[model samples]
Target: MYKRILLPTDGSELSHACVTAGLEFAQQLQAEVVAVYVAGNYQYPLYVDILPPNGPTEEEYQAAMQTLAESYLQPVREAAAAAGLACQQVIQFNDSTAKEIVHTAQEYACDLIFMGSHGRSGLGQFILGSVTTKVLSLCLIPVLVHRIKHH
Candidate 1:
């Protein structure tokens, strides 16, 4: 009987599928939802001399990421509203998305995390490092991984 569910999305097709399912489940439970989107922070050097002349400044990069996050989160908001569920949306810019997700769950007092996995295996998953896997490793709360098997 999870009271609050955290749905973390990356705007991928698979992620959207998970969010949709999560929303439906939350609707059934009549639980509050927390939708979170994490954008990567700009980590490159900010010195003017070391950067390209036409390259965006750190502030510009941050603004762009924030805008992107808003776009990614908009659908979740609309879907939650349609489901008549209470949803809290959060946008975070951080290099480590898994950490941010765990933090958001803890900060919001979410009992469960519902998120998607690309279902990669072997060399690809090894090299790419699955954020979902990392979140599973790090987070204490229950995580329902919606593993999408692409054909």
Candidate 2:
């Protein structure tokens, strides 16, 4: 019973799985889809007094980040088009991805969020933490987590 489905993707294979599942659910519910990519924030300090300057330039880093964020949306866009659903996309650069996702959902008036679960086992999950878990903790909308099993 979803009217607006928000799908956040990162261009990972797992995210693709999530998109596929989300598309099916959205189609079944006759819902519109919103694809979002949250660019990880840049928090490093600017160091202009380095000895030998051969590192990536500020403009280069920004361009690379933007490319990565946009690249993640390509497959999702194709999938939505093939499914014949009304689709929209947004790219956000945020320190907290979970927070951005929840905020976007509210901003877009989405009813449900379909996302992929990074199937990390006990120890790995404990060490790395999980964006999906964080999103679930803060989101007011329903979240469907698609766990892609790796063989």
Candidate 3:
């Protein structure tokens, strides 16, 4: 029933599974997929003066992050093409992953968001904060989280 599906991936093995599942679901529903990669703005450490002399410049770090984000989204684009489904790629530079994801879904008018869950423990989730959890709580749209099992 979904007309447009948003798939947010981080290029991790867990996210790869979600990409595969989300694409299959989109194919079945004849829905368009919007794949997004969110990159946080990198900030140099405060003690730059005392830091290593050969540290990468801010511009260089940003470029590398963008390149990595592109690599993460490339396979998703190819998979969509192979499935004969219309797809779009988005790159967002924001600090809050969940906020960016929700904003993208709203901006794109996507009905469903399919993403992977890292499946952190309760304590770990509390300490590190769970992006999927935050998205679920904040998003108005329906979210389908694929939890990958580690063997």
Model 3 clash count equals: 0
Clashes of each: 0, 0, 0
* TM-score, model 3 to reference: 0.86
- Where model 3 places Cα greater than 4 Å from the true spot, the runs are 47-52, 120-129, 149-151
1-151: candidate 1 lDDT, tens digit per residue: 9999999988876678889999998999999999999988877765646988777888999899888888888999999999999999999888999999999999999999998765445664334237888999999999987655556
Listed in order, each prediction's TM-score against the native is 0.87, 0.84, 0.86
Q: 86, model 2: CA deviation in Å? A: 1.1
TM-score of model 2 vs. true structure: 0.84
- Tell me the whole-model lDDT of each prediction, alpha carbons only: 0.87, 0.82, 0.88
**CA RMSD for every model?**
2.7, 2.8, 3.1
Q: Show model 1 residue runs off by greater than 4 Å.
A: 46-48, 119-129, 149-151
Superposition error at 140 for model 2 (Å): 0.9
Q: Model 1 TM-score?
A: 0.87
Tens digit per residue, CA lDDT, model 3, 1-151: 8999999998876688889999999999999999999998877778867755787787888889889999999999999999999999999989999999999999999999998765445554334238988999999999997765556
Winner by lDDT between candidate 2 and candidate 1: 1
**Predicted candidate 2 versus true structure: per-residue lDDT over 84-149, tens digit per residue:** 998998888788999999999999999999987764455543332378889999998899877665
Q: In what order do the candidates fall by lDDT, top score first?
A: 3, 1, 2
- What lDDT is reached at residue 41 by model 1? 81
